[model samples]
Target: MILQLKEVNGMEEGERTALLAIAMNLVIFGIKYVSASATGSIALKAEAFHTLADFVASLTVFTGLKIAKRKTKSFPYGLYKIENLMSVIISLVILYTGYEIILDVINTDLTELRNSGFAIFSLLIATFLTFWFSNYERKIGHKINSPILLADSSHIRIDVLSNLIVLLVVVASLFGFHFDKIAALIVVIFIVKTGIQILMDGIRVLLDASVDYETLSKVEKIILDTPQIIKLKTLTGRNSGRYKFIEADIVLKTHNLDRAHFIAERVERITKEEIKNIDQVQIHYEPLQKEEIIYVLPLTEDKTSISPHFGEAPCFMLVTFKSGTETASKTEILTNPYANIQKGKGILAAELIVKNMVDFVLVKNGFESKGPHYVFSDANIELV
Candidate 1:
């Protein structure tokens, strides 16, 4: 699903191949049916029935490709699932084809079935061709993760089996036991089994069944990694085609709506970037309760000066302002020197209140925010 028909270009190529397969099946079936009729061989007839099944299956695949490609006005989601439904139909066609082989084998003359050497040879060729085609399709299907192509590959696999059965029936008929009829019955049973299996799988998908555990686990991990996400409570996911849609509810230890909104947006962005084949993501946020913290401001200043006559290294001065109460009366604090003394490098600075409480407050007291009030620790002036 990840690399395959998930994109439009891949879908188009797959559809083209399906159409080509159907046309080829039609040509092969026509040629085999004529040869089988002329030979009057039970095994050839069996092979012919298998070919007929291929014809029907191919047509179903073609129809499915068309339906799958349609973007309906009524259904906003594309009709990609129709391809699986068509595969189910093809399976039924295979079962019917097997059944017809059994019926024809039973109703025909046993004596006429003996001269089917050419028919048996043709079935052998068909078997080899179908086997090769099935293997090729399987490789591509696996690469793209396309269910339709995989189904077609399965159809080819069954064709190979049916041809083998026909070959064996011919050989056994030549060996003198009238076992062609029995072989036909075996083919019928095998086809029925395959048909039932394909139908069940298709129905399950149509019902929106859950995917495997590995996929769910991966999705959960991605959601958990979303930024600012305290916890993920529930996650529900579904897929229409190659795109997986997700809905998740997340919680955080923040009460601010703006923060929650920002976190949700981050979560959405991160989830999309981390996960592959995701088309849409919806996140719901729940705020966790926490205390409303307030800030305290502190006053501070710093200065340096040079003196020539005294050859002093530098003149430095220290000043301090402390808030006596646990909570600063004002939200902001500013500092100024008591005297504008021979200003060489005198400056003023401000700090804001960071933490406020009845007992003690945390303030951005200059030079790295030490405590409750701005402490103007030092100053200096230079004389010419």
Candidate 2:
């Protein structure tokens, strides 16, 4: 039930963000177009067209989010790549807007500047709104882990800078200085830069590139932290739209098939808890091959013999021996850190052995009714 909630909430949040961006773009477009007509500034007109392009891109993002949610028997994995496709489309639109702005700068003459104060005031308002929306949308994008929303937010952020340049150009024209064409050219550069960045990101995801190193490292840590996991063979993750898909292979200390599966499920659950927007986790596990067995025995202060009490032992002896052999290949003595703990010492001792990856524990008697017994059982550590 909790997992279902996460999926539904993610989609709803992405859709809401896209819709908000569309509305903001519409408002900014009207403001910029009105101001451009009033002041006859070429830069202002270019900005108006850029805002229009943003509107189209926002609409594209909304459509993509809607379509990405649909699942069919023909496409069981969902149309998640549609979000990446929308990002690509948005990049193309941005590139076209930049090209149009460049052409306007070269071909159009700045008309007589009028209502200079009104133009500056209107641009100031538009820039403020764009700045606010960009930050807000970016925050939400990261929260929901939506690629399209993040792309749109980046597109809108560039608009804020372009609006400022246009405003400055309008102000300069009032003082009998002309920089409209130069300002429009600068805005074109920003638009093109942002467009290229978004294009690369979309292409990488579409090609099934590996997820960021930071995320993969976190997943590796999670898998390694599981007590029963002896080795993490491979871990791979990729982004599909706003969600992440993961695959991992691991070796568990237990030879029992059911125990291996249980450990895998535990890993999956913990991974989902720590990471956001995980779509699926596929884990493949195999039992450890018994070449050598590591046995831990709770020992007395002298470390020469086993202690009758498991948790109250002052130290422990670790013996490693090859399978079917009686002689020990290696032996080491370790001081029990939790021996002095007044309470829960048994459970802590069990955890200590699990953390050391000991295959078996030699006990004087069965700890069937103790806390340590359950801990050892859960970790799949055999008792001898």
Candidate 3:
């Protein structure tokens, strides 16, 4: 289907973005590291470590995607949760780096920082690359709906802002204004905030928290709008990394067991069509309980004559009995779709009757019983 192809394309795009992010993060890290060592600016050093954290986050995204795509039959649900687990690991790494940066600010001698024009050039480069890359990766992340890429993008966004503050510190030192440690402390706060945010999101996915309320509402609306589904009993949905899965139970206002199944199938199809991100949908249906005896009769067009043939009949007349007495009746002259088929007519007709939820089939006296008779017998459809 076109939809399936689009999904694959989106996934490929996410992978490509992750690779790009790793390269950019590494470049930023190297540039910042050089400046930090040359001038001994605490902010520059913290920014270097933040870039390193971003690099690791990018690697985590790549590894998670590779593992998630290798799902096997033993794990039919796939390995999507691996992405969330990797996110958690990435967040903890960032948190540790953040604490280190905070401690460095608290313990290091701030008065020893050396002012240098070359450090400003390096910081400028770091700032521009991080700001541009963050926006680029964020656009890609949204395009593919990838949580890993989005998480990594968030990390890079903080990198851009922190790099700006580091640049300011370098500029201020050149103007006889020295508050490098204070600026570095500001960067640490931003880094820690981003880490906590990513950590909470990862933990939520690992715990199987329910999806957003808007998505849940949309799901409920889709099921309720299905024609034969009279009522929805229950609905539960959860996220798996960037994807979603839903399980539902519904009540159908139909006495026929076969029609109930077909309705449920329609609901599942419609739900998937309406919502593209849902990777799995499980639907359970119950038929309406009513005291009725239903019978199906093969008839000629206009209901004027009996058709000895079952599969070739132009239409069928449905009759219903209640309390062992006639309650309601209807005759439908629907086209027999299998009439022109050369083979499998009997099976198709049997399936049609089952879909109608017929209890009995009235046949003309001399009707043959090779194909349809056997089919009806297997389905417990009495022929008389």
Candidate 4:
């Protein structure tokens, strides 16, 4: 049950974060666009395009998550990784946008910088908001283990750095060195760096990389805590942007097949509950021996008092024969020999098979009359 909730919560958090990014980017884009057009600043223009890139990336995230939530006949394994693919696409788009901004800055001619003072205040506000959004998105990304959100955070982080660059340009313009083109070149580097990082992360997930160490350790701890589980042999996990799949092998000290199955299932259930991000768990069972098997041999009724030819008794068996033969015409014997038998039955020899030395007290003084009769009858010798 907790497993089910964790899966749902992870998805919900990812969707919420994507939506928040889209909304924030849209607002930031509008502010930067207006300021850039008013001031004729190349840095502001590039910053505007950067915010626009974020807006599109956020929209891509929203659509990818929506598609990923859906199940299809063709894709039985839900579309969780679609978001990762989209992040890669968005990264490329951001990179292209950055390149275009650089080319435009290099080609354009700046006649005058208008309303530079107002643009400075706007860039400062944008920087503060970009930092806030980046940190928030990163927090949610770690909580949900979302690749898309992490990618978005990386882009916003670039915006914060670019805004700081633009701030420096505004300050320079106030006191000499009003080189708008130089600031624009710096913004290009900023966007390119962000795009490269985002792309790398998305590609890693698309290639089906395993979840990190912290999550794996959490899962291992859960399996170890399950009742009746003696040891955990192996645990493996992989991530698909928002979903996690884990497989584990466990060893149990149960020879009984039923008990082993029950313990394995419990381990799987506990693992899913204890770990927050796992969507599916597969468990393999290994049976371990409690102790080595000890063999015992049956004995005839008359020879019950005598020890077996092999050694001390680990167990004993009782055999019944057809009528009319003192030598027991037909042989029927019990292999599992830890059983008690009564006297007055057809007298035969009883053999006790043993692992080590063992002693048993005679009951009712009947052993004294039974004597140490070792009847070597011609019968089949079966061990228990």
Backbone Cα, N, C clashes tallied per candidate: 14, 0, 0, 12
In candidate 3, which residue pairs get closer than 3 Å at backbone N, Cα or C atoms, i.e. clash? none
| lDDT tens per residue, model 4, 295-340 | 2233435545534332223224332333333453333233434333
Q: Estimate every model's Cα lDDT from 0 to 1.
A: 0.59, 0.90, 0.80, 0.70
Q: Please report the candidate that would top TM-score against the real structure.
A: 2
Question: For model 1, what is the alpha-carbon lDDT of residue 310?
Answer: 16
Indicate which candidate wins on lDDT. Answer: 2
**TM-score per candidate, in order?**
0.67, 0.93, 0.75, 0.71
* Per-residue lDDT of model 1, residues 213-316, tens digit only: 66567767876644345578888776543346678888764566786777677766766666665556788888744233233222223322222211111222
Model 3, clash count? 0
The Cα error of candidate 4 at residue 299, in Å, is 31
* TM-score (C-alpha, index-matched) for candidate 4: 0.71
Listed per candidate, the RMSD to the true structure in angstroms reads 13.3, 2.1, 8.5, 13.2
lDDT, candidate 3, equals 0.80
